[model samples]
Target: MFAVSGGGRGDGSWPGARWREAIALTLETSTIDNTDNLEPTPEPLHAGAPVRPDSPTFAELGVHPDIVRALNEVGIERTFAIQELTLPLALAGEDVIGQARTGTGKTLGFGVPLLQRLRPASADAENASRDVPQALVVVPTRELCVQVTRDLADAGRHLGARVTAIYGGRPYEPQVASLQRGVDIVVGTPGRLLDLAEQRHLVLGRINALVLDEADEMLDLGFLPDVERILRMLPEQRQTMLFSATMPGPIITLSRTFLTQPTHIRAEESDASAIHERTRQFVYRAHALDKVELLAKTLQADQRGLTMIFTRTKRTAQRVADDLADRGFAVGAVHGDLGQGAREQALRAFRSGKVDVLVATDVAARGIDVIDVTHVVNYQCPEDAKTYIHRIGRTGRAGKEGVAVTLVDWDDVPRWKLISDELDLGVDNPVETYSTSEHLFADLGIPAHANGTLPKAARTRVGLDAEHLEDDGRSGRDRRGAPSGRRERSGSSRSGSGRSGSVRSGSGGSSGRGEDSRGGPDVADPATDIAAPRANRPPRQRRRRRAGALVGEPATDERIGSAEAHQSPVPELAGQGETTRRPRRRRRNGGASASSQANQTVDTQDAAAS
Candidate 1:
């Protein structure tokens, strides 16, 4: 790539000229365009689902006045391409498959209609009490479930739509209580939604509309079976709306199987690519150790507003966010490791400009539609082209200019090459660049003498310290150290408490004060006393004395077998010293060796007890 000037996208042209091209691409001049069909008023299966006459605001799209006021309350007035296309059909009760890139307002596309149909503004728009949710939204991830629910709730504020979000890693009591009280709409991850429906807590027989948000993510997460099972539970006569950034074969099959004569509508996208037109992409071959250094410099670039950094794993996301925060950038992280409340806290702070940089793993980043994100940094190479598009799409949203930088480690070259070939990005071998390299400064328009750290004076005043997040009402293993979400409901941390058999543990499970999990109580061991589910147990305290205690034991193999049989069936009780949420460590060798090693440990423990 030859570049004549600094800040040029290799051709000495900034995104301003190209942004016009994007506007032209997304905002069609003709008001009569119907996307798949050019007809002004395309006929639908239902007469009630009518196409509205040309008008500027959402009110003209058959959205109710109260809901329109709610959209305005959130500072959203005008409609986007997807909203323009999908709203009319959806409001009229027509099935729709909306395919588009992320950040194109797909939430409002289906949301506007879902609210209008479910909570009409006439008499019930302001009513508080509602029975048996009329709508259900199934999403891929917990983060997305919360996001969609929030968006819909915001949009339905005036309409009094009781939108509730439910997902795994959360206690079932709150959700069950909400369902019992009755809700107007429920947005949830597939697993939790299915669970609630089966328990008869979430009724689907009366569901008027079902939304499968982010179908591609659902497929990637292997939730299609759950999705199919969920769809099967809904009323056959209901409206179905499916939205995805990409439409793969499985998604197509799902649509064919579940949707009834669904009309495919796309916005802010071309079938050739899902990458945004307003984003300038740069791929660089950077040293793995020094990628952080490069990222620090990039964050200092002029106009680098609310940046997003993508990592492959949950651990990496936390590490990067911590590293950036230490460098004096207002940073927050989203990943599986953080509690739901913490994740939402980070996202909210980022959205409010209290934190301008968001570090995230792909699982937690789906359906994150924050606006004004100026950059997306791929801290790790994406697995495929689809993922790359999704990451960078975080920036350049709603037709704004954004810069996407990918720091490709040497080992990731082959995978990067594959993605580049698939997307025709033309940078299969990214520029061999370092943190202090001139090309980096020239390409990103970084100020001269900019180091890998921010100046004390340049640090933003609003940071994570200045932001406050609501509790997610989580406890124990799933809490991930976040404050509880429902404090009023948390008068007692115990939801459903029952006593099982008295638990017995070895000396390894003793507390520092000389009491064990099963000790006769002068004071009961809090761990066993709580009697919570194994999945919600606290971090164990066993590993510290494991090898020391085993060396003193002398029992034979037969005693180990007997001890193992008498051990608690709940795995948490057996290993009361390990964190409940983490996976059980597998041995380095094959299964037979692992079994042998396990038997030896058990034999040693049994002998020590004897």
Candidate 2:
């Protein structure tokens, strides 16, 4: 993975063009667009009267007037639903468990409270020169850490709160230096958090407010033990806020183990609300290789200004974006290999519409809130329901109708079915399709057979034909078409031959035939049976009868010799109509073994003919 900057290579050529094309083709072909005449918007649905704070202002949410002024300066006049629900409780120093989806103003839900809780360095001279962070917000991946830290800094700018992010896959010295410089809040992933803790470079003992953003994801990554250890190191009286979209058993277990009887604020997402009301849910079954194609087509449809694509892997994220860019779609990728600066640059381009698509892995794209993301394509169906929700949640933000297209591989049928059932999203049986499926064009609102024949610039943004894929020889798999839409194996890597567990059924040799033959019993020969026809049987009769002619009785064995004259091996005289070939009789030998062998040979041929 080459380091990319400014959305292009140093030479000014778009480095992601190949990837853009690949992604476009995968998504466009794989997605099955909805034809259900359901309009995009529905009615408003909220649990209670919109929570009305005593003072309907930021200052009433325990935010210092100076902080409120700072927030107001940034155009944040009123608190969002999440901020209103979580701020009052957080300001009161109570542990909180806030359940909300992405793009729901969750950053400020915890950020503002944490910033408000900050206290100037203690008067102790011994600690005045030393720098130890008082807060830690642990996220799942590096990209989210950077995104979260930036938001926290922006919200806390006037308060002069120093926020720092430390995540893995980059230089450690800078993080250590940042720690030395005394950051007020440290946001990072589990591995780096543990590393820094063990190195004694960052201390959490004095942490007053510990926020576990996207807590379910941290739990999913097997970081619960680390999270527990980190929690143990913090002050016993510290406030712990666990936030996630969907709560699972493991997360609940963690909350029970660590968080005090927290305020259980459940902000349910309603299909009738503006956010959920306008979100369009489309489900389709398609070949795995064709996902990028399907997405390409969807992105090009309706001129939806910006889109974010979610894939299950970093490699897939890169490939999806690269495929789209190659097709001339202004696209960029955000994942682990990129630097914070590089990731930010790509995101800026996407937000500004300079780049229409941002392909990202689930972990990398978390906490990234880009408004009016017209479409969010799950290039690959997520591993489970929670992930599926998060991937699509990127779109449908800020009360705008957004489209989410999920491309399901055939193998993912079971997994996606479970998600569909759980979410009540009536789309469980995805249509089996490939890149060439006519339905794909209809779904994208593109004319069938329009591929490649369109103007180059228009085609670049979407609909790549099979002729453009790079050759990396592997096996008999078709490169020009979409993947077979088979489920990807859990640990099976995608090789040049493509992912495994493919079903092949047609005319072919059987592997078990040889084994069966080796163990089977042999059959008996009947060539020399005394009761058999003498050397020959009459040619298979094709009898024709006169209109009034009578048929004769069949010949008996006793008269076989007389009738045998007509059953000659050679053709009968020209005047004769038909003849039967006589089975060659073996000359009898005095030796039983020789005679038996000859009879066996004759019987084998007779059996074959029969």
Candidate closest to the true structure, highest TM-score: 1
TM-score of 1: 0.67
What is candidate 1's lDDT per residue for 208-323, written digit by digit as tens? 89999889989998999999999998889999999887778898788778887666665545523334456788889999889899999998898788888999987687677766
- The whole-model lDDT of each prediction reads 0.66, 0.60
Regions more than 4 Å wrong, model 2: 1-55, 122-127, 271-276, 287-294, 335-345, 432-439, 447-455, 458-610
Expressed as tens digits, the lDDT of each residue in 33-108 for candidate 2 is: 1111112212111111122344256886668876787666645656666666678888888887877765556677
TM-score of candidate 2 versus the correct structure, residues matched by position: 0.62
> Candidate 2 deviates by what RMSD?
22.4
